[model samples]
Target: MPTPDFVLALREHVGHDLLWMPGVTAFVLDADRQHMLAVRRADTGAWTPVTGIIDPGEEPASAAVREVAEEAGVDCAPLRLVDVRTHPPLTFPNGDHAQFLDLCFVCEHTGGEPYPADGENTEARWFPLEDPPPMNDRFLAQLQIVLADRPEARFRR
Candidate 1:
């Protein structure tokens, strides 16, 4: 579902209030690690990694994998947690506000061609890792961290 049932239920009590949520960004790399999956968001038309809110009681890594499949029409396995950071708070056009604790994961593409499977995105495809399409500063920063392949996940201080 686009909006989770839990979030809808909570909205009944807190209309338009900022809701702190846990989210996932899945950087899905092909088996050979030469390319990464990206999706053009339907709302913003910006290219980004597969992103979604983690369901209540769901593991972040599992959410990453699930998001890749949901948004990009591909199966993947989380290779590692790459970053943990708080996203800037924003209000939706509908007046709902939310801030996210983002868990970014590097996932290995297990199978299937990439396409925008969900209405949330318009286009989904693989891009060369060395030269991905342009992204906003926030996403580019996370991309750089993933490319560095550090031993530990980056935690914003």
Candidate 2:
């Protein structure tokens, strides 16, 4: 489930060539907005908001909701798109290279308990907004944006 079938098909043809892909990150807050859900990635062991590649023809908001549920075992309703940015290209340990246009959404947890529901993550839990597990600069910045409670989405220009 980590790599989509479409992406796998493309990889079969292109091998390790760089792929430009659309991705989504969901910062899901509890109903009271005091806790944020995070997952420790299986690959990197870093705690981050729920993130996944957007499937072909999928709506971004729906993708965010789906990723939150799939990764964290929690259903969520995307409140708003919080940020859009193109991340720097990355090469996985397996040598597949890709760059992502990440669309970040601030979502409200609607149901279900959080756990690492998918094999992609090793742990999943809710953390206090004031004291979350350490994350990379990109995710940290996105968290700050969601915390600011902005009504409008940020677009990197």
Candidate 3:
């Protein structure tokens, strides 16, 4: 995972202190609706939809598109906004702390096969949505919200 330069600079100032971050997650589904592309994170070996931090000056939707390409080697078009959510604070193994405001999106697969294009993922592949590897509540919720195809975006106050 490439840490944005700004985040690296911020860490220089605050070390492991908590920082609020903006991020994006992509639920990349297949045309058949049976499988979705996801990554098994290299760090924790946990499965997650394509996700990455939003760079400074970058649009959230753009970040979601970029994450899908960079993490899964797939091209996609944002079909709809899924949700805007604030996740609980987290601390990495190295003790860096952060809270995230995540923008989730559903992307229609445009082209390319799925693979782990970046080092952050051990593997990237399409998984059956009905039996996705156990994931956090937020991820499952986003999956449900996106799958529903509701006209309105899911929001967290």
Candidate 4:
């Protein structure tokens, strides 16, 4: 299957000049703490947390807020930094090669209903913590770390 335009652009940029750096991922929780907001990637069908690449001039916290709004159409106030992770350098299917340092924050949803804001995501829904959507082991591990009372954990460099 052909890669999506965004992926293609990412690959091209990374393959040539741009270098991907630290990014932020958000695990947004509802007021009742019964649900967590997640987004389904259109390209990979992976039900993952809301995340985005931190722009050059942007702070990681601000990036987290922006990404949550962009990917999940929700306003959130990040409660605290939860976990920091690093993905090994690898070439994406679209041919982009780069390493990612992910800063995962746990945030509380402040406003707006969950919905896909744009091309970044296809579906946004509140998932019960007890019966979360299918996700990779890495993501599950990160979620566990965030839910734990510890300050933060680092993994997979």
Candidate 5:
């Protein structure tokens, strides 16, 4: 993942310490709703739905779409807001600590083949709902919401 300029500026002061950041996750489903794109994140090498940190001043919905585009070279038509949650603080191997407030969305794939579009993700593929690649526990929860077709989104209080 390319560190954004905003984060770089903050790191100058914080220096890998905990930073409260905003993020977006897109559960990009196919038109039939039976498949979705998952990308192997470059940092973790773990397969997850396209996700990225939201830049300062960016809307969550737009960030979600942009993440999918950047990571997977895919266009998405957002279906609805699905869930919002603060991911538990994670400390990187290099000792950078951060926590994310994530806005999750369920989007339909509008165009483009699922391919590695940016260096953030090494691989991208469409997976069937019945047999998704392994994912982190947090992402698995988001996958549940996407698969359940939840009528309403989970909003942060």
Candidate 6:
């Protein structure tokens, strides 16, 4: 996948000084509660929820909404914060090492259908929440926790 122009510039200018910012990811559930919006990432083909790094001056919830719109062409309202996770410091394929604190929000889809927003995603689809495609273990675990009646279960590092 091609890096966004802004991200490429940030890496070039900041080099190792680039920091991992906290981000918010949204699992947008349809009104009927039968489907969840997900994207097929062009880079990895990894099926994941709408996600993006929080802008320097943006709040997590707002980032979630903006990412959903930008990535999936959908408008959403955060229903509740489902999980807050901090991944161990790691490097991306491009050798950028950083730690990410991710706030996963359960969101209600307010408008728009699934449409891949150009470079950000290759495909966007509404998958049955009950039978999501295989995903990373971390995300699958988080989804299980969020789906349970108790949405506040915490995962320890």
Candidate 1 per-residue C-alpha lDDT over 26-143 given as tens digits, one digit per residue, 9 for 90 to 100: 8888888899899999988899998999999998998998888888899998989999999899988889999999999999999999999989999999999999978998889999
The prediction achieving the highest lDDT against the true structure is 2
In the predicted model 3, the residue pairs found to clash are none
Per-residue CA lDDT of model 4 for 49-143, tens digit only, reads 88778776788888999989988889999888878777777765554566778898888999999998888678999999888889898778877
- Candidate 3: which stretches are off by over 4 Å? none
| Candidate 2 overall lDDT versus native | 0.93
Worst ten in a row by lDDT for model 1: 1-10
lDDT of each structure? 0.91, 0.93, 0.88, 0.80, 0.89, 0.82
Please list the Cα RMSD from the true structure of every candidate, rounded to 1 decimal place.
1.1, 1.1, 1.5, 3.6, 1.5, 2.3
Which residue pairs clash in candidate 5? Answer: none
Write candidate 5's Cα lDDT for 63-115 as tens digits: 99998998899999878999989878999777889998888999999999999
* Candidate 1 similarity to native, TM-score: 0.96
lDDT of 6 by residue, 1-157 (tens): 4444666677887785546768787888899878888898988889998888887777889999999999999899988888888878887777776688899888999999999976868999898988987788877887776677474636566
Per-prediction tally of clashes: 0, 0, 0, 0, 0, 0
Tell me, by TM-score, which candidate is best.
Answer: 1
* Candidate 2: stretches off by over 4 Å: none
TM-scores, one per candidate: 0.96, 0.96, 0.92, 0.84, 0.93, 0.87
C-alpha lDDT of candidate 6 relative to the true structure: 0.82
Per-residue accuracy of model 2 over 1-157 as CA lDDT, tens digit each? 3799999999999999999999999999999999999999998899999999999999999999998888889999999999999989999889999999999999999999999998999999999999988999999999999999989999987
Question: Higher lDDT: candidate 3 or 4?
Answer: 3
**TM-score, prediction 5:** 0.93
Ranked by TM-score, top first:
1, 2, 5, 3, 6, 4
